[model samples]
Target: MLFRQLEYLVALARERHFARAAQACRVSQPALSEALRKLEDELGVLLVRRGRAYEGLTPEGERIVRWAQRILADRDALRDEVDALRTGLSGRLRIGSVPTASGAVPLLTGPFCTAHPLAAVELSTDLRADELLRQVRDFEINAGLSYLPEQGTEGVRTVPLYEERYVLLTGPADGLAGQPHATWTEASRLPLCLLHPGMQGRRVLDGVFAGLGLAPAPRVETDSVGSLFAHVRTGHWASVVPYAWLHVFGVPPGMRAVPLVEPVHSTPIGLVTAAREPGSVMARALREVARRTDLAGVLGALPKA
Candidate 1:
């Protein structure tokens, strides 16, 4: 019945442990349980499945939790609105980002901070594109920085930020190093190190290769951007990565970043937020900042690898 009860229930659903949920809510385990039980009684439904340990929520609880997430999000937005009117916008702006776009996050965050000096930022950069969009839609994050999904933007709104062109990163001694540009076919033949196939960047690259009827067999497969760079740094392997990354992590010494030609591919990265009516104020502010951000001038102006 009360916002605090909904807060406790939402926290419990997120933590899935009575003790941890209580810890997050800054309350005792008994207090949180009693509050949720009262919430269930008031709503005339059983919400949680009880056990000696915390069990999963009931089906109704799942539905109620979704409602709770929305209610809490709206309540927070109201508070932010009032605060903005009274003084200025202030709160933690949560942002989720795909790893490939991690380098560009600071470019957006820095200006957002400057625009709203009282506001704070929290970033989780490990989410993949699909997961990032899911979280943004679920109210789990205020905004997302990622490659725009080809589908599933029905409930999302995005502001285009920048475009990333693919480049071949290789040592001086590689066969393609001296060329003005390399093709997907040429890059596929090298002793290559690549991101894990599940990553968005990898999947994009895979799709391009698949279209060309060439399947690259990598010498090393990793989930880490740093690891891929490290492997290529050893001079034994080559990699194809987004041109945007060169701004943050320069062409690792002894490497040349030749443009990938023969049907040059580019991925559009953007600011993704939920398409729901009356969205988060922080998210809107971020979009405004992204609109003004010369991210293109920052990364796009770089010598095309």
Candidate 2:
């Protein structure tokens, strides 16, 4: 019944172990167990599955965990709101982004930090579109920067940031360097270094190739953009990357970037946050940052894709 109990329960659900959960909550093991039991007694339903180890949450516990997440989120939102009124917005803002959008993140974060110097902004690029949404929904991240989902999703509001276009980055020594544009089919035939299949960007590229009836077998696959840059910078490898990336990370010394054409496709990328009304002050600030950002100016300066 207590907010502390909800906190403990949520922590337990996340950690999935009594001792670790207690450690996360900065409490002793017995205290965490007692709090959960008291919570169950107050609610008259078991909130955890008991065993020598953390078996899992009970069915009712599963549902309660969700509610606990919402309640804690709302509680934090309330606290942030009150503090913002008194201190002009001070709190940590967490944002998760897909790796391909790594370059574009600074566009939002820069202004956000400038506008609210007192606030702390943490940006992570190690998540996929679905994972980004999941973390946002779970309140693990305050917001997400990712490709817009095909179908509208529930419990989240999206603000379209910009359209992502494809391009091929290779060194001047590469054969295709002088080409005005390359098709997905042609790009697939090169000794290409590409993002892992798990990445949403890779999936989009794969879809383009599949539609052309071309299956690309990459020479090297990596999850790190830096790795792709490292290989391609040698002028021996070519890679397909977002056009914005060219602007973000300029065509490195010897590299040249060519737009991907002949069935060129563009996907919408955006900012996503929980749909909760009266959203956290930081969340609202990020929304404003998204709105005020000149995405066209940023992406437009880049070579067209």
Candidate 3:
């Protein structure tokens, strides 16, 4: 019946614990429970499967949760619109990005902030491509920086940004050193540190290796790019990573990067948002920023590794 009640219910469903949910809502446990009970009474349906402990929501509650998400999103969109009109656009722009594209997001957000100084931005890089698409569609994130899904995705809009190419990172004494470029086959034979297979970058690299009929067994696998760099700094390990990352992270003191060849493959990365009409003002602003971003110029400014 009320926005606060809906917020309480949504928070409870997400946390799945009465005490924790209450903590999240910044209210007492008893107050949150009473609010949910009141919401159920007003709606004339049993929403939660109540017990001594926290139980899951009922089927109808699940439906209501979906509606609550949309309603809350619309409410925020309205607020953003009014705020933009009153002064200037000012709200948090939540962005989900895949690990590989994480470095390049600043290229878009930098100019965006200069244009709309009042706006706030939050970027999360741990999400995979599929998670980014799902979150964008579910209104969990305003937009995402990810590769276009191979089979294509539904209920989403995409703004093409740039192609993601890869390079091999190694120390001067490494096996592949002194080469202008290294092939997948050539790189696979070395002691490599790579992202986990669950990550989009790793999957793409796996696909390339599979296509080449090669299997690369990495000496070290991790989720952090920083870790990969750290290991490669030992002068005994190497990694194959995005070309943009080489420019973004800057080749470490002892490390050098060489382009990947023997068939250079590039994947397209872009800004993805929900396809729903009347998108949030922040989402629209990001799309406009993406349109005006001179990706080539930005890339050219970085020292080539």
Candidate 4:
């Protein structure tokens, strides 16, 4: 019934281990266990499956966890709203983003900080879509920048930021560097260094190639954009990256960014936040920044879709 108990339950659901969950909540394992027991007794339903190791949650436990997420999100929003009204808009704004959109964070953070100078902003990057949603649901992050999933989750809000197009990054000496644009099939023939399949950006690229009936097999793959660019700078391996990232990476010396044409491909990226009543001050400020910023201009400057 207590907020702390719900916090413990949600932590346990996330960590999936009693000890680790307790550690995350800064409490003893036994104390957390006891709190869970009391919560189950109050609710008259089992909320967790117990075993020597951490077993998965029961059906009822899964349902309760959803409610727990909603309840905690609402509670945090209330506190934030009250604090913001008492003082100025002062609180932490946690944001998560994919590596490709990392450059766009400054667009939001810079303005929000300028507006609310005392507010603290924490930014974490390169999170998967599901992980980013989980953090928002758990109130770990106030908002996130990610590619909107095909199917949306309940109790979440999304604001489309921009459509990202892929561009070919190659050194000046590379064979294809002279071309203004390259087709997907043509790009596939090059010795390319690309992001691993786990990243959303890579998945988007894979879809584009699959649509063209060409399966792209990169000569080298990496998770970090920096590494991909580093190898491309050597004029050895070419890379496919988001167009917006071209300027951010500054097109390493002797490199050229060519737009991929023929069957142009792009993915929509957006800002996602929990749909809780009485929105937080930080969340409102961020939404304002998103509204005022020129996301379309930013995307327009990138390669044509």
Candidate 5:
């Protein structure tokens, strides 16, 4: 019934352990347990499955917890709205982005911060596309930067930000360096260093090669861009990265970044927010920033190899 009780319940559902959930809620174990029991009594349903340890939520508990999430999100939205009316926009804006889109997030965050100096932004750039969307839908994050889902974007609003283009980065002495452009076929022949298979960017690059009846044999594979860049710095490794990355991290010394052409490819990356009635004010603010940002133009203006 109380918002505090709902908060505890949602934390419990997320943590799946009583003590950890209580820790997240900043309350004692007994306090969290008593609150949930009271919530169950008021709702007339057994909300948790208990057996000396935190087992899991019951069937009805599962459904109720979803509603609890909604209720809490709506409550936060109301508070943010009222706060904005009084003291301007002020709150933490949480955004989750797929690792490949890491460079592009600054386009939105930079403007958002300047526009609303009172607001705080928390960015998580290590999430995969699937995990990013899930957090957006759950209200665990205010918004997400990722590719549009193929099947359906049922529970979120999509705001297309930019078209993500690929570019081949190589050292000066590398095989394809100084070239105006490199095809997927040509790039695959080098001692490549690419993102690991689990990343969306890797999957996309693999699909492109698979269509050509070729599979890239990477000499080095990594999940971190820093590591990939380090390998490319050796002049013996080449990697394909998104063009937007050049906007944030310019071509390092002794390196070149050429557009990947010969049947050019681009992925549509966008901002996703929960499709709820009273959405988070922070999300709405970010959407406004996205509309005003000339992301495509900014990324396209980067110097070409």
Candidate 6:
């Protein structure tokens, strides 16, 4: 019945371990367990199916946990609202982003912090789309920067920030370097270095090649964009990456970025927040910053999709 009890229940649901949840809540395991037991007794419903180890939540428990998350989020928002009225907009804003969209975080965070000087911002990068959505739903992040999958998200609100265009990067000495555009079919014939398939960027690139009925057999695969650039610097390999990444991984000397056309591909990248009504002040502030920034303009300027 108590907010503290609901909090404990939610933490347990998220961590799936009583001891870890207790540690997260800064309470002893016994106290946490007692609180949950009291909550279940008061509600007259078994909120958790406990065993020697942390099993999964029951259907009723899952429902309760969802309610708990909303309650806790609203409570936190109320506190933030009251605090902002007294002290101006101020609280930590957490953001999750994929590697390709990492550059855009600063564009949003820099101006947001300037507008709300008391606010703090934390940015974590390289999360996949599903992970990003899960974090937003769990209130682990205030906003996320990720590709808007064509299928669309269920319980999230999104605003298209930019359309990311893929470009071919290679040393100037490479035969295809000076070319203003390269086709997927042409790029496929080269010794390429690429991001690992697990990344959303790689998946998009795979689709582009697949559309051409060509499967690019990369000479090397790496998880880091910096590594991809480094490999291309060796003058032996080429990489296909989003244009936004050019600034983050700084095109190595002697490298040229050629637009990929003749079936050019682009993916819409956007900012996402939970679909819940009455979002937190931090989330609202981020949305405001996103609105003011040149995200759409920057992306729109890229060569044809």
- Look at candidate 3 and give me any clashing residue pairs: none
* RMSD values, in order shown: 1.9, 1.9, 1.8, 2.4, 1.5, 2.6
lDDT tens readout by residue for model 1, 10-38: 89988999999999999999999999999
The estimated TM-scores of all candidates read: 0.93, 0.95, 0.94, 0.92, 0.95, 0.92
lDDT of each: 0.89, 0.88, 0.87, 0.83, 0.89, 0.84
List of clashing residue pairs for candidate 6: none
Pairs that clash in candidate 2: none
lDDT of 5 at 97: 92
Deviation (Å) of 87 in candidate 4: 0.8
lDDT of 6 by residue, 1-305 (tens): 48999999989998899999999999999999999999988988988888997787788889998888888888888888888999998888889998888877887888998999998888888788788988888787889999985665777888888888888988888777877788888889989999889888888889888988899789899888778888888889989978887656555577888888978677889999988778787888788888889876755444322
Off by more than 4 A, model 3: 300-302
Worst 10 residues of 2 by lDDT: 296-305
**Poorest 10 consecutive residues of model 1 by lDDT?**
296-305
Regions more than 4 Å wrong, model 1: none
Model 5, 79-188: lDDT tens per residue?
99999999999989999999888888988898999999999999899998888888888889999999877766889999888888888999888657777788989998
- Model 2, span 1-305: residue lDDT tens: 49999999989988889999999999999999999999999999988989888899999999999999998899999998998889878899999999988788988889998998889988888898888998899898899989999875898999998999988888887677788887777788899999999989899989989988999889899998778889998877899988788776677787888888988799999999999988777899999999999885788556532
Ranking by TM-score: 5, 2, 3, 1, 4, 6
Q: What is the C-alpha lDDT profile of model 4 across 86-154, one tens digit per residue?
A: 887777899999888887788789888998887899999888878888788767789999998778577
State in Å the error of residue 296, model 1. Answer: 3.0
Tell me, by TM-score, which candidate is best.
5
Model 5 earns a TM-score of 0.95
Error of 3 at 208 (Å): 0.7
